[model samples]
Target: MDYLQSLRMFVKVAELGSFTGAADQLRVSSAVATRSVASLEERLDARLLQRTTRSVTLTEAGRLFLDRVRTIVDDIDDVEGGLLAATGVPSGTLRIAVQGSIGARYLAKLLSAYTERYPLVVPQVIFSDGPISLVEGRFDAALTNDTYPHPGSVVARAFAHLEMMLVASPRFVPGIHGSAPLTDVDPLVLLSHDDGTAGVEPDPVRRWLDTNAAHATHIRANNSDMLRGMAIEGMGVALVPAVLVEDDLDDGSLVQVMPETPLPSMGLSVTYGSRRNLAPNVRALVDLLIEQSKSDQLPVALRHEDAALVAGD
Candidate 1:
């Protein structure tokens, strides 16, 4: 058995606190990861981890070993980076996980520009609606709304703040009293993402609805696009991220239901595992995202409106 490989696996298992999670991160089977850690314990003649059906805990010896191993790993990474830098071109695969709507709306432009600038660097993007675990997913970085919860192993950067709007179809708005207080709107149709209301609370729209809209009816959709489509068809009102429905609102396909009550802004953040000496590709992509985020692009709704105005002119 490769002692270094076993030690690496052991450290990963300790950091994650589960063999299964470590396996997922390492791209190996759970059984293989378990055996690797076991082999390391045998070689060291120390029971490094205390394990149970519910959880895994590191013993005193394990904690000491981890501290020493982490330093060695950091040194190795620095040496590797110095050697790689000598080759002149930064080249590697960068795996990124992003939310579906943001990826669809903005990633293409950013990715196109990035590829143009770094032809040798390849990017693989994974899109999902909910947050993904950086430690479990083995991704180089993730673009998500929720910041990572754990410390020491991750770092987060604010990418952008998304402005949201509540919109309804023209037909839906005509019957409803425009001057009526937001609380007085009848048969209020609330569109939601996913089945349950996680990360939906403490939202501006949610807070407003909780305080003012007593008779509001709730509707759930699995994705933002679905919610927007339902709202555009006059099925109900949807509090959607402005970027997602700007085109429809501008084209008269949908109308802003309450222009005054803007949904509270939420940040879009990019996070990465804070491994020593981040991969060149990951570092390059992070810098690119930061640069792109600095530009003053119009909000989605305004951009859509501008397009319509341009066509008319």
Candidate 2:
């Protein structure tokens, strides 16, 4: 048995806390990963992990070994990266996961620009709105919102700031003057993100409704696109990222209702697993994104009437 390979597998299992997850990340079968870890435990003459049908947990000895093994593995990766960098040619399949909403417009443009700059690099993008596990997914990076300052074995860099707007269908609010008081909007129905409000503390939207429009009916949907569709159907009002609804607003299907009340902006960030020496290709992509973010080209634009309303308020 290759002890080095076993060590690597053990480290992955420790980090992800699932044998199946480690197997998937390493691109190996579950049986192979199980055998590798078992072989390591036998060599050490100690039980490293306690496994249940549902989860994997590290024993005390396993925890201590994991801390040391992570350092060793990281050092080896850095050395390999240094040697690869010496070749001065960047080439790799960069696997990335992006927020589903942003993937359509902004991310598509950024990716097009990236590929043009680095023709040697091929990108595989997964679009979803769920939490991304960089190591478990074996991805080079993730472009997402919601998980800011990501925890252990991960790093996050802000890529874009997305402003949000409160909007409603023209028929629902009818000639809704921009300066109209929010209190006066009658028969309010709020379409919101499905944040599982059964037990947990209410999210910002629910809390806002509770405080400002407690009488308004609330409907929950997971996707922002769905919320936009619901609003356009004249079902209710929705507070959504401005960029996602810009075309709709321009076409007069959706109208901004409360310009004076600025919904907090959502931040987009690129995240990757923590590594001492990131590959040159990955680093280049991260740098390009950061530079683009610094230029601030993706500013949110509200309609002219809405802008005036904010100014007047």
Candidate 3:
């Protein structure tokens, strides 16, 4: 018995829940597919599957074996594709998910340049503000503000850091003394992701306000754009990421309320599930993202040492 072929058959059977379905996918007869899996079980002296008239289910051993088999198969495919991609051409779909705010400001330009360089590569981008689980999602990779906890099964690279700032429209600025500290502002207008959490908690701006402002009120907007628009109309002071409001700051539409105390920068990272090898397409996308990260145009936070050096200089 071909061990690898048998393993593939087993996985297909487990996934499809029937010998006929597996056989159809593998383009072989149901009998052959069934025999291969049966032979595999006999060779190992273990039954990997439980067969009923209507459905097939994995036994305990089969469940454990399936996870390992999937990893191995994925690695083999990655290795094969990596070898093929060495010829200087990468062809495949690269699916990526990113935070809504980040993607809104940067994805269009990045995709344009990436596609121009590798026309054979197709790109799909999903935007979300919530944490995306790699195991459950079909995404080849993701760009996010937070790092993953389990690095063993995933590869992660820090790409950028973002500085958030407190700002208000010209009209709102007059409500408080021009030189007052950020906390003195009343009626804060906040923008946040609509992920069910109250905008007042887990937010640095909210924390700062709670600590410093004796009298603070909040108006929560579900989307960042809505938040910005409300703030622009002189609703109240807003704590927003600097990059998102750069243009407004430049045009004097928005004024920085507290420029002295910079909000701590958050790191942006690119991550993918770590396989021993990867498909040509996935590898290509990873490489491109890494290269793009090295460029000055990408948003990143300064390293502590780098910040120290700048301060000293």
Candidate 4:
């Protein structure tokens, strides 16, 4: 049997869940497609599919084999695409993940621009408030904050730094002013991503909680947008990316809590598998992001680091 061709036929059959459908797509006869998959299973000595008159399904072994086979196929395609880089246009589904509201606020625009440039590449976006795994085969690339753990098998390139600041509505905590010292403004309610259990390395907010917000009520939510909304409604004080609340600050809806103290800026990185050569779609997306990340019009983009960015730990 032509092993690679069999694998391709099986992959298409598994994806479409119909032998006739797979055969039509592969431009082969249904008998040829069925024979290829049967030959594959015979060689492997494992039943890869459960065939019924109505539909087809993958067995347990088939499911596991499918994942690895997909990788092998994709890697082959990536190498071929790279070889034809000069002539071929990048095409395929590009799956990307972003950390949270901050990513949605800023990185979404960059992705929108990327789609415009690479129309052939379909983009799938995942927005998460917690850790994202690149090796798990879920995401092709991700936008992650430096605070979160990055897998060693991936390469992380920090491009932008978000200057975080403590903020709240003036009506929430009336007496706090810009000139007031950090010691004087004791927050009644602390709105944060961590409920003091996350054990994230000490940042400005964590240090502040050590003194001022020590005895305060902890209002924890995984979503930064939710925390920002809470702060806007005068529910509590929150540490947020300054860029996200610019309009609120200007409109007197939200005020900066601590003006004198410097808050640690969170670094943003693009994480991908540590391949020798990136997939065509992945490389295009990353290069476009690096280009789009350095505009003087946006304060966060202006704060972007040089090309010599910090990599994964």
Return the top candidate by TM-score. Answer: 4
lDDT of 4: 0.73
Give the better candidate number (1 or 4) by lDDT.
4
- Taking the tens digit of each residue's C-alpha lDDT, what string does model 4 give over 70-176? 66865664566457554557789989887766556676667678789888999898887667776564688988775566644345666778877789998975656
**Residue 276 Cα positional deviation in candidate 2, in Å, after optimal superposition:** 2.6
**Estimated TM-score per prediction?**
0.65, 0.63, 0.61, 0.65
Shift of residue 127 alpha carbon in model 4, Å: 1.4
For model 3, the run of ten residues with the poorest summed lDDT = 304-313
The local distance difference test score of model 2 is 0.70
Candidate 1 is scored at a TM of 0.65
The TM-score ranking, best first, is 4, 1, 2, 3
Q: Write the per-residue lDDT of candidate 2 for residues 1-313, one digit (tens) a residue.
A: 8887798789888877888877875678999999999999999999999999988999999999998887787667657766665565567799987655653567777788889988999999987665556666778888765333233345566566666678899898764446555566666677866532245445445556567666657787767889999999998888777878888988999998868863555556677664435777787777677667656444444111110000000
Q: Which ten residues in a row have the lowest lDDT in candidate 2?
A: 304-313
N/CA/C clash count, model 3: 5
Q: What C-alpha lDDT values do all the predictions have?
A: 0.68, 0.70, 0.65, 0.73
Residue 115 of candidate 1: its Cα lDDT? 90
lDDT tens digits, residues 1-313, model 1?
7776687678778877889877865678999998998898998899999999999999999999998996676556546655554454657787888765653577777778779988998889997655566656678888765432323245566666667677889998886666565666776777755423355335444555567655778886657889899988888888777778768977999888766653466556677764335677776776676666665553443221110000000
lDDT score, residue 114, model 4?
Answer: 77
- Off-target runs (Cα >4 Å) in candidate 2 are 1-88, 146-152, 175-184, 195-215, 299-313
TM-score, predicted candidate 4 vs. hidden true structure: 0.65
Per-residue alpha-carbon lDDT of candidate 3 for residues 9-69, written as tens digits (9 for 90 to 100)? 8977776677986676566898899889989999989989999987899999999989888
What C-alpha RMSD separates each model from the true structure? 9.0, 8.6, 8.6, 9.6
